[model samples]
Target: MSEIEQLLRPELRGRTPYGAPQLDVDVRLNTNESSYPVPDAVVRAVSAELADELSGLNRYPDREFTALRTALADYLATQAGVSFDPEQLWAGNGSNEVLQHLVQAFGGPERTALGFTPAYSMHPIITETLGTRWVDGQRDAQTFDLTVESAVEQAGEVDPNLVFLCSPNNPTGSALPFEVIEAMLDAAPRALVVVDEAYAEFARPGTPTALSLLADHPRLVVTRTMSKAFTLAGGRLGYLAAAPGIIDALRLVRLPYHLSTPTQTVARIALEHADLLLETVEAIKAQRDRIVAELTALGLAPVPSDANFVLFGGLADAPATWQALLDDGVLVRDVGIAHHLRVTAGTPQETSRFLAAMSRLVPAHMMTKENP
Candidate 1:
């Protein structure tokens, strides 16, 4: 092995960093980022907040980040229809960081974490990198469904110290049924259950959030980010709602003053004008539904989605279809699934471009019974 490889942590050596291809393209949908930009009014407010903080950059940001946490609690109360105290909340650079803080506190060399496969890729990365053993759980092979029976069985079998669950799960683009979450908690009695709700704002109507279950479930954690529906991906703000005790545990692992002044200011201002900032949500959801309907009409199988992206299958060759779309100036994610690619919902015009590109490639790249 090379010197640096040898010096790397035994678990980390030969690992690929978690990221999507950040290629410049006309219709980029590889990452599940909001296709809309932040509103000008919110931008101006953020600018004003930052200008006021510049003179105080000499001082470290609030170690507690009290103001930001209060703002986040206010937003969640309105968004999720559930109330939370600021003390019951914790935040970090992104949801990923909050997740890391969780693993660091609960998962270690001899401890284990369990996550269903085809969920967020970062769950495994964070768990393993923190010196915890990772157990690969499963979803249905055909439909990607995690039924409560299956989830309960896996959790009981693993008896892990930590469990990762993704609602509006990544790459699959579907929300987990609340029954599965409750069953998991019951089965893994000793495990801390984390529900990554990064796309919570985009879930379809009638979809219930895990946040509602926190009143009685001390082991439950529900994390959300401003990167998606809030249209503040660059702002790097993510927070979670859990029992006060769980929030206290996260503080033990978080680096002191880890959130900077600017990050706090940007997120808080955006939260203050949350209604205006969230105007594009309906538009994005419209586009997401359109993509699913159109793909299904084209003979591709799209998993029913509650998130802002759609995972479609029936590709004869996923990588080749990915390049074909990129060549047409529309980039989607080839998530390493055998015949599926995940595409983020963008603006109406961008959606048209992606669907048109798919139309051109389908006859050649799609898998049909005769073709197969």
Candidate 2:
């Protein structure tokens, strides 16, 4: 082993860091980022907020981030139809940081964190790297569905200290049945159940958010980000809603002035102009459904999606098809599933480029019933 490798923490010694390919392609739809740019008015507001805060850079940011939390609470009340007090809100660099806070405070040596496989890849990475045992729970092999029965059973079996659940789950692009969230809370009574709702704004009508259950479930947490629907991926703001007690616990683990003045200003101002910023959500959803339809018509199988991406299958070789798409000036995610790839819903033009590339590769690159 190399000197650095030998000196690394034993658990992280050989693990690859989590990232998607950042290639230069005409249609870059690998990461599930909003393909839209910030609206001009929202940009100007953020700029103004930052300009006012620039003089205060020498002073540390508000350790409590009081105003940002209030803005976040108001946004949630408006968007989710669920009310929250500022005391119940927490913000960090990204949802990833909020998630890490959960682990750092509640998960550690000898503790266990559990998540169903093929969900967010970061759940396992974050859990294991923080000196916690990661239990790779299962979802249905054929449909990628997590039944309430299956989740309850696994949570009961592992008895983990933290459980990670993603709604409109990453890679699969489908929301968990809301029942699964409730069942998991009961199944793992001791575990803090975290629902990562990074794409909540893009959910199809009638989809429920865990935020609604936060009033009754103290152990429940729903994390959201400005990166996707808000079109502020560069702003690096993610926040969560949980019981006040859970929010209190996170403060114990967070660094002093963790939310910088600029980050706070950008996110708060973006929240104020959320309606203008989210104008593209419906357009992106249209493209998401279109990708599902087109992929299906081309004889590929796409999981119905509630998020701003589609996970399609029937590839003869996923990595080869990913390369083929990239070669055609488009890029998609080969999410390590045997014959499936995930593609983010981008602008209509980008969607056309990706579907055209996929259509060209079909029959040659796709799996037929005979192949299966």
Candidate 3:
């Protein structure tokens, strides 16, 4: 080990890092990216704003982001079906960074960060990097969800300083019930509960959102992003809705002038055409439905997803199937969980392309019952 590695904490240096797959293919469904391009109208609006604002790049961007922050809070309040104050708002480059900020502010070597396993890989990454202890609740794979009983039990054991929950969770794509989240709140009312809604837009209605309980729970912090369903993945905009006190602490740690003028302008412009973005969201929902139905027809069991992607397993076919898709110029995620693969709900054309590739691998007999 290098001297720096030696100087570093011994426990952390042994941690295994998260890995993202890099595939060589045309139809890329590895990342849960919305295949729909931004609407023509949004593109033009962003261009108009960029033209008006780009000249100011030489000057520093807004440190407070007064207008952009207000707009974010207002729009999120309306969309999340909750009331929010601008003072309760915070923004960062992405929710990944925003989450890092949370761990940094609330976590320490002595304090533990609590979360469930098989979640958005970033959760464990941030917790460990901050040198905070990680207390993980167990998962229920048979039901493909987490039980509130498990969450509460684990929280009581660790008495962690923070709890992270992802609705319609990453990788697995299952939505935890609101009651489960509330039970978790009851268990650890003192610890901050960060509900990551990165894939919130894609979740079907009636699914639970943490925003509704934010008013009653002072320790709640809800983080969201414009990257997934918003079609501005490259824009790098993430925001958090937390109590004013939490917002103030994060603001204190924030690097001055964090958001660039272009980022702020583009996010605002994107918000203006909310209707246009919802259309793409609707299409993804439809595409997701089709993907699930078709995968079942092929005798592949995909966990019912409330988000923009689905996770399925075909132990017999996983490796060969993944390689087959790649050979046929399609790319999908092999997330290292044996026999399981994650596929994004892309546009109709993209779905069709994937179907074409998959049909070639799934055999004729397995169309009714999974071949052992």
- Give lDDT tens digits, candidate 1, residues 222-287: 998999999988888888899988888888899989999999899889999999988999999999
After superposing candidate 2 on the true structure, give the runs of residues whose Cα lies further than 4 Å from its correct spot. 369-372
lDDT of 2 by residue, 308-346 (tens): 999999988898998888889998898999999999999
Which residue runs does candidate 3 get wrong by more than 4 Å?
A: 2-19, 22-24, 364-372
Cα lDDT for residue 75, candidate 3: 86
Q: What is the lDDT of residue 115 in candidate 1?
A: 95
Query: In candidate 1, what residue range of length 10 has the lowest lDDT sum?
Result: 363-372
What is the C-alpha local distance difference test score of candidate 3?
A: 0.83
Deviation from truth (RMSD, Å), model 2? 1.0
Runs of candidate 1 with Cα error greater than 4 angstroms are: none
- Per-prediction backbone clash count: 0, 1, 0
By summed lDDT, the worst window of 10 consecutive residues in model 3 runs over 363-372
Candidate 3 lDDT, 70-181, residue by residue in tens: 8887788678768787888888887888998899899877888888878888998898888888876668866557887888888888787899999879888888888878
In model 2, the Cα lDDT at residue 306 comes to: 94
Candidate 1 lDDT for residue 201 = 88
